[model samples]
Target: MSDIFNQVDNSIYSNAMTFLRVPLVMDPIAAEADIAVLGLPFDIATSGRSGARMGPTAIRQASINLAWEGKHFPWKFNLLKKSKVIDAGDLVYSTGDAAEFTQKVEKAATQLLASGKTLVSLGGDHFVTLPLLRAHHQKFGEMALIHFDAHTDTYDNGSAYDHGTMFYHAPNEGLIDPQKSVQIGIRTVFNEANHGFNVIDAPQANDMSVEQISTLIKEKVQGMPVYVTFDIDCLDPAFAPGTGTPVCGGLSTDKILKILRTLTDINIVGMDVVEVAPAYDNSEITALAAATIALELMHLWTVQNKQV
Candidate 1:
């Protein structure tokens, strides 16, 4: 009808103002935001694999195609869209010192939390979650964790800030309470015999069904503020082959989504997705999975906050 509306391609371009269409800010204005995503690209010290340092960029590139369905998201419940989420880029890390890197991550996370915004973190490794959680605990204190992974990640502080020890190390730091924490999709083989951390593995419980695990998560995290962390290696390599440490017998992408979706009632204060190494991914499937989970977490946060 009008030249301004001339032959638009809705199939390729839906909305210009959606989150995916905006320019990714390296240093976004922190104070006036609803949700802030900061990347921590320092997985160099990871004992499992070192490629996770590239995870943030891969997830960012994969997120460019994210769409806004407004209220009717086909993947999950129609989450309210009142939330404002933005990428705040990666924090600087020291290659030499683990403690220094942890401090830097804590600083960035603290700044974002002070803004009263939810932190959707793109991680360097699972170890980065420790620093992020350290900041959240500073403000909230003793939040429950909904950890998704193949291994327990509770290895005693072996040497330094590596991927295998964040869960164990956090509790020792009083950042996470092991009794209140809930871990899902935990497969064996990476246990005490394999030099892994000591965590209560729910997937090993009776019948090991998604419903069973979901119920356990609900029961464990009830009435407690929650932090949800997703490790790409948590999924079987068939679904997420790009992680630095690809583990077998892990949860499927669909299974992980189902568990997270059912936990919508918990107060999800912060979130992180890590260990996605694009270098090993031939089909870009791992990045896609990570990006999709990020959007799902955003939806859950938005719905809970009534932002949609």
Candidate 2:
């Protein structure tokens, strides 16, 4: 999506609203983008802090720092140059009903995917991934999930709408194949039942090198369509404190980004950076972190689907 996700030459402090000020579109197909960005601004499913509903705006504002820059550092390619990216704006849905909200998100996602554009979501909370999975499943057909978070979010948790239970429900609904998936950066507790996905708990991730973590992720998701979900709380509170459920002893910022950079070879279907609650953040740290993660995701997408 050349010039799609990015706006032309606005100062970082300028009034850019869309994620990186990319042209806002109501219809992705008309834009003919290679990739599209959408905001899932519903946090009704959170079991913790409530303000993730504001995540989309906050992350977009922070992304201004990256928007005006011609190219991202360390990476040898220009994302805007290689791909057409557009901000399709946020999903429009009634805020009153959980079922309706989920349906709207999925419907919006389905429409975007039908355009044959890959999606990168700015989430309202981790629960947003549930509907996202539903949408991607229809296109890619049961992807391998690469989840990064402080909690497994796979708990039964009684209700079908809770953020913690989406993973539990996803595998059952045929959206993802648990055996081919892997969950990383988890520090919270959950039953070790043959949940099918391999676990790289927080301690394990912290102790492991980037090579080890990436190797394990690649091995687990080998030759499969992959969907990556990064919950901002995967970083310690020191790195990302403005999240719904922050956990200590998490991976550092450098550690996670490094791991992501080495993952361009994976067949990624869809991705999101969820659970960033800017209200709890100091000095915009969490939002900026989320923004950077989003950019890195674009890099990953561009490399995988390199355009002429």
Candidate 3:
């Protein structure tokens, strides 16, 4: 019915730009979907990189290939079979104004959540989580964060606009529950003293099996409303070298996917895949990884919220 299927049947190169060639809608409520894909293209807060602003478009381009895959592996059902998903396009905000941008992000996210459709966000940078958290909290109260990153992002205090400082404010501002939250694959330095978050640092994660990590995550969250924010940098530099701040050692893509596959009923409310600066990516792997992750998030949403 669509050019995505008609002209490019099974082709990785599709003429459609919307993620997976799903309809691009400005009016999400009119789209009648169970999930809304929102793009946040503000990257002014990046401390180490600036190109993540282009991430959303690159991710969409990469996802053209996924639209042709009938059934995603490991999951027997097609993600879209049970419900509708609309790409609500990218959030618009004033250019170059970080303060105004955060407000726009929060306002737009709040509006999407108001539609009662789960949101799968495509991020400009890790800092975008701040506004997202604010909006999600207003809906689900304080959520337990399932953060995937190379840095703890709990810089404690300093540089309010920096991506590294979002968690420092998120819990304090009541957007997330630090005690119920967990940061996985962290290799950077951050204060740990009773900071509330349970951290599975890179070394610790590497030593543990994927099942062990997944069990730990499930235990910490314990059915609390969860918000998953995945930084592509959480993958080792060999896997995701296009991110702003690349760390040498981190979770392998296989390890992260294995863990996520086990999180089928963890009460996830919202999710995002951030920091795919395509300029530095090798052979589009970073964008493809982000797209695959995004699709998996959709699978998680669909299968868990199954039709009664």
lDDT-based ranking: 2, 3, 1
Each model's lDDT: 0.74, 0.89, 0.87
**Model 2 clashing-pair count:** 7
Flag regions of model 3 displaced more than 4 Å: 1-9
Among all windows of 10 consecutive residues in model 2, the one with the lowest summed lDDT is: 1-10
Expressed as tens digits, the lDDT of each residue in 1-308 for candidate 2 is 76776645577776768887778887776778988999988788888888998999999999998886668887887788798889988887876588998988898889889978999999898889999999999898988999999888888854768889989999999998888999999998888876677999999999999999999999989999999999999999999999888889999999999999999899998999999898999988999999999999989988888852
**Least well predicted 10-residue stretch by lDDT in candidate 3:** 5-14
- On residues 1-308, what C-alpha lDDT tens digit does candidate 1 reach at each position? 89888754334234333234343566665346688877777776577657888888778766655544544345444433366566676777656677888888888788778768889898777888988999999888888888888778776646676688788778778877666777766775454554322243534632366677777777777887889899888888999999888867766788777766766677889999999988888677898799889878887787677733
lDDT score for residue 188 of model 1: 50
Q: What TM-score fits each model?
A: 0.85, 0.95, 0.95
lDDT of 3 by residue, 173-253 (tens): 988888899999999877777667999999999999988999899999996999999999999989887888899988888
Model 1 whole-model lDDT (C-alpha atoms): 0.74
Tell me the alpha-carbon RMSD of every candidate: 4.2, 3.4, 2.1
Candidate 1 residue 238 Cα shift, in angstroms, is 0.1
